[model samples]
Target chain A: MAINKLKRHIIIFVMFVTLMPTGTAIADFAVIVNKDNPVVSMGKSDVKNIFLGKKTFWPDGSGIDVYLQRAGKAHRSFVLEILRKSPQQLSMYWKQALFSGTGIPPNQLQDDQSVIKAVADNAGAIGYIAPEHIDTTVKALELK
Target chain B: MKLSRGIFCTFLFVLISLQETPTCLAFQIGNHLSLNGYLSQGYIESSGNNFFGDSLDGSFEINEFALTTNYIANNQLRLGLQLLSRDLGEEGNNEILIDWAVADYHWQDWLGLRLGKVKLPIGLYNQGRDTDFLRPMVFLPQSIYDENKRSLLVAATGGSIYGNFFLGNGGYLDYQAYYGKVDFREDSGQAQGIRYLVSNISRMKNLGSVSDFDSENRYVCGGSLLYSPPLDALRFGVSYFTGKTDFDFRVGGRKGEASGTNKDFIVLSVEYAQPDWKIAFEYSEFTGDRKALGIDIPDGRSQGAYVQLCYHLYDELVLSALYDIFYADKNDHSGSKYADQGQPDYLGWRKDFGLGIRWNITNQLIFKAEHHWVDGASLQLPIFNPQGVEEHWNYFVLKTSFNF
Candidate 1:
């Protein structure tokens, strides 16, 4: 009986070790603007609405222009970890908006550097990238 | 087609909504009756030329206004009704009967059946297209589903059967099927789909007399099957349908444009969600015949698909982007068109890239903005041809939408 109990203990311990999460699971995000813009803050919803086409103009009704890095590892991760949209739901919205004449989608840049460059020059431009990609041209707006 | 849409939207806003008041007030007599209904309203402002050469301007005023309500019967059943209107303007005279009907049914945590005037289960978006709360965008795409109001078939007429099916894999499926006849205004005087293209039922209207026009019927039968697997954060859906659509246009005084069609649609979707961040992608297509003028377009097939990526930064703010494409061709039987017109190719296609940002000021209230660049050609619309690309076109658009 003692031997059987000992075996059970071993199994449970093995399971615990196997189930423990490894590596860095924490996600980091940043709100990017043109390096030269004076605006410096935002809310999560404000960012989401701008991307979803729900808010066409800025808070003050300024013409807002949004840019994105082309389809790639960084772009994909940013969308999943920061944008909060899945590949499928976003696609459906695109077609629905386009065919219905509600709106068109955005122009895709080839990489993170390109996106950073675009957002850095335009006051109305907004986007996000990895914290490492942050440079002198673009400023990161801390979220509330 | 344009005329047919105007008439049907008008019918949806004017005709159907009128009948709802009487059904409610009639029951109000001799009762402490306080009746209320669900309300929904919105409008579409776009800038682009459509299939019919109509230009879309970027504008927004009021699109819909509705009030739907009901009464409780015994513990097992409820009686309900709705009054709806869309596309209201300041000076232009525009109104239609979008929804005005009553329903009676029983329900529980797992199963239910509703009967009366209700939304039709035509496409992924048609059933709930009018309510902005159910979707992120202002309208569902026309390539997959169109939500034009119709006068031929009852919006939520007769009855509908719905149930939940479990796949034993920690996944679930929702199924629904309905049987009813619809009122068409374009030709049958009922709008088939809402996007202003299929809204014109009068284009084929050859039937004579109001009686003949009002006497058309559309026997529609279809169902949707949805599945979400347990092994992955993925969802799948398949829809099948077969029915006889009636348009008011008459051949030999038949009083209806009776055309038979089959529908098959497939969807594959996936979602990877995490705290503070979530992303989703869905691909769907409709493959079947679009009945028109009693002709089953030969080689008539249409398809559409899109991919989107998004990031939620904070409570009401997010960033997103997408790529889209849709195509269709006119199944022409006339070996060829006039020599001057040649074989009259009607093939069409469009591809687009977009980026967007949105802010949700409140849970029920949202403000959104988006930008898009487009390429490709639509079979019946204006297009640009790149130096080496076939009929390549380019254009950009900016848009905004709000719902409460």
Candidate 2:
């Protein structure tokens, strides 16, 4: 009878752990721009175009300086979710643009902190990072 | 010896550059100018026929080197130029030539203009063929992108207008329209093919041996449209080109002038990509008319198509497979009518199955190997193969490339 009671307790504990709520299933990354920029929100397509080097200017007629992380979870999520491409595919796309003399790829930073710093420094710069990395120096753009 | 020296110098230069700046994607000369280049060396071997040199005996006469520079004057204007030197058997011969020099102006998201020597938007991959790292296969589908006709089809000296349009949930559209003139070199494969044709015609017409062959492209006009659906990694495209060429040849000390018009050259393409796999299909048709010495040659339409699939086994390794087909005359798929002539029936058609592997050792370095089993001689020009061509043949190629 004591062994059976211990088995039941173990089963109940396993079920409770499995049923516990995780904060959010998907980790959310934030797209950021300089605090002084006029842009507050942007559509997914607009972000895609800017990263692709197809959209060069912002609404205020200033050149947009795009920044990206070299390789990280935030980079992977941004590429797969927003750009609908793998990191390798994005790299190949940039290489194609370079070789074809079409456009230049954005400057790549090593980490989220570097990307955050880059966007914070340039008025027209834009980048993405983990939401926890967001600070007062940069404004997080609402992804439409 | 000259070829060896050229290869050595190019290899040494690339090695030094890589060592100096292994991580640089492009060397920046200043605030406005940036430079990039790539070098590729390839070896080819064949079983039954010569290809891209004396491939039957294992040829190393395939290589390419190019340097491209871009100067961004402002947010709206950019100037670009590329100097290229390549050798494929008897063509190119490692002579430096202008691949493209263009002045591009971007007005807005939906419009742009480019003037100067511009790369033609033929099928999907023509503009990127010079860059070995752009594709998984060492050679693209030969049926649609015949290596022999590369010079004639690569680019044109003219102007182009291009644009991209967003379609909300529908997708996006990219369009290009161009007008230009193509320059054909004397040592080019197109020129050699023309020479061979003139010689054969002379023999048939009893006009004696033909010599002093010259050809000029009068003008070319084309347009291309590509659409990407809302679905991820799916695209469909169509391209059309029309051009005319004038040729002059001396037959037994007599000068004769002829002209050829390419009417309704069209290509349709589709490609789909996933994270680890991609598939592409393209079909092309060329309808043309030829007149030689005021004698009308029979008009015919040629057709070509290919289906390619690529799978990435790892982040740096890719495997590709291809099935390509070509016909000299779309109406005579069996080549029975072609056999009525003296030439072999296989000359009228070609069917090929190819397999390739590409390894991206680094962001700036790549290596590739491919083999093709061919069942016809359609694009194998007689000028390159005095030893003759067999109906069943195969070829292998190994290539390595470095870029910065």
Candidate 3:
């Protein structure tokens, strides 16, 4: 009976992994920058680095200010697709950075609209929002 | 008693400050200044030996509290400091001290500088050892990160050059080189070891009573490099450090000095992480040479290593297992040679198998429990265990932490 229960747990775990969303099936969100910013396109690696705080400056030498949604579908999609990290992993990464005094995590907003508004007001700001939430005040980058 | 009062007051202040905003990730005074901290309390129990303060009968002597502040002067400059108070057995006693303080200047993605008391990069996890919320286990692998020698290896007061470099499609590399002097305290494990040695020497050579024991570091310097290859989620790293220290004491009203040098101290590390699980491995080796009171202690190379794995069962739960080993003298793994000198055979080595569970009760709160089956007595200092040590022992720990 114990063996059967263990086998059942293993099967369930495998199924969970198999059914998990890959995050690559659809590009439901757009990476956005301030309208005044000159950057037009970004590679996946570039976005990853910027989000990770590894890339701190733009070509114009302006500091990059990052914004993110605290929690939402768009936030999850961006974290999984662009950052290539699970939400929990990302949270742990930021916690590690904060506690170690190495770097600070990006400012998190409550939702997509807040992030979009924050990005629009800061010339050096970058954020992500669902395609339907993109507005004229922000320039959507062509993610490669 | 004073230290305990101070720690209580600090803890009260932190609690009061946190009451208003329970979910704040970091307290921000303004756009440029932020504060973060963590507090942990733990209990330990053991069978067959005492570990971390009379653990054979259970103890709550393990606890840590730290507060860090960061001020960003501009895009290129930042200042940070952390104040820490901890109690581990009879070591820390909850006395507050400066953990690390640094003024960091970032010039570019490939170049940066830091000046002040900087953390030493010994392994993949050394820099974050103080943050209990960062790992799945209550204690890190002791073979490589011996908690007893924490004061000697935690940080150094000086400067460092560091940076991250992109390698196009081949991933990236992070590097840091540092130089400074480490602080030595009378109650530190290293100092205790020196005192124990002096006591033995006093008996063997009729050197008489010893007192006023102290130690000083002449210098410490090191560098570390981490490379992430094209393989996703895989990282490889190597860190090296060397230093010299002097021990001073009085024997029979006569001053005596002993100097020790640590050479070729190195650690090699590798880790691979997936969405659900992670695995890590590290190995370290170093040679120590000492000359004390006109007697030259034979140079010995020590070795340590561990392999650990963690599985994320849920967003808030993690399970971890570790196998760690350490040899006081790599050439005498069996300890027979060490036993020939009158000490217990187990004194020369330690091997441990541990299992742990971590529950993230909340983003800012965590609970962890772990159990270990250990053989050997290398890390158990003789000064603390006057009754002698057992060849086999087991210990369990339960810890909870709150952070912001």
Index of the highest-TM-score prediction: 3
Off by over 4 Å in 3: A1-23, B1-24
B35-73 per-residue lDDT for model 2 (tens digits): 777889999999888887788899888988877778889
* Model 2 Cα lDDT, one tens digit per residue, A7-57: 999999999998996644655578999999989999988898789876788
Candidates ranked, most accurate by lDDT first: 3, 2, 1
Candidate 3, residue B28: lDDT: 72
Q: In terms of DockQ, which candidate is stronger, 2 or 3?
A: 3
Q: Which candidate should be chosen as best, given DockQ against the real structure?
A: 3
Q: Runs in model 2 with CA error above 4 Å?
A: A1-24, B1-21
Candidate 1 vs candidate 2: which has greater lDDT? Answer: 2
Ranking by DockQ: 3, 2, 1
- Over A1-144, each residue of candidate 1 has an lDDT whose tens digit, in order, gives 999999999999999988997534543446698766666887655565566554445555465677765456656655654456553344334434322212334444666788788887778788777778788888998775
State model 2's lDDT: 0.84
- List, for all models, the DockQ compared with the true complex: 0.02, 0.48, 0.50
- Give lDDT tens digits, candidate 3, residues B1-404: 24564655477476647566554345777779877778899999998788867888899999988888889898889999888888888788778788889999999978999899888888898888888888879888988788877877788999888889999998989998999999987777777777777777877899899998889999999999999786767899999989999999999889988887888889999999876799999999978787778788764898999999999899789999999999988998988776788879888999999999999888778999999999988874556678988889899999999887
> Model 3 reaches what TM-score against the true structure?
0.93
Clashes of each: 117, 0, 0
TM-score of structure candidate 1: 0.52
